[model samples]
Target: MQLEPDDSQSDRPVPSLAAPEFAAGDRVRMNALGRSRHPRYGERQAVVVRKVAANGWRVLFEGRTSLLTIHRDYLEKVEPV
Candidate 1:
């Protein structure tokens, strides 16, 4: 089943406390804060930032090999090893 877009969330800015702006080659990890559709829900992953919009970010996950639009709350920045 496809989920419909919620108009109330359109063009909303991400809270500063939740997530920071990421560059093209930034490393990030998914937080285990809630149930996620991702297979690696709480694992570290490399991502290339396609774009950052007021609503959220468009990113490509290297590990999962999927491009996804995710909310800032679902991501957390991690330093590259």
Candidate 2:
């Protein structure tokens, strides 16, 4: 499913226009500087398992077993040619 802009945001950071719509099975990469303290922060890539919200996604990071809900700001769509 695609993300719709969240007009309910109060103090939260708004989602960027550059952030692509995510779907299950799509490959994505986590920003190296995103979520510095997250356990999966070291992982460079992941698969989008679900879009949890307009700004969050459930991802399965490469080399990891557990699924992590990472914000969309930290992910970029990996369009394969």
**Highest TM-score scorer:** 2
Residue 70 lDDT, candidate 2, scale 0-100:
80
Candidate closest to the true structure, highest lDDT: 2
Per-residue lDDT of 1-81 in model 2, one digit per residue for the tens?
A: 999877787545456777767889999886643645454465568899988866789998888899988877777777797
**Model 2 off-target regions past 4 Å?**
1-14, 32-43
lDDT of 1 by residue, 20-76 (tens): 667677777666541264555557565757656764666776657777777766667
Model 2 gets an lDDT of 0.76
lDDT, candidates in the order shown:
0.64, 0.76
Pairs of residues clashing in candidate 2: none
Instruction: List clash counts for every candidate, in order.
Output: 0, 0
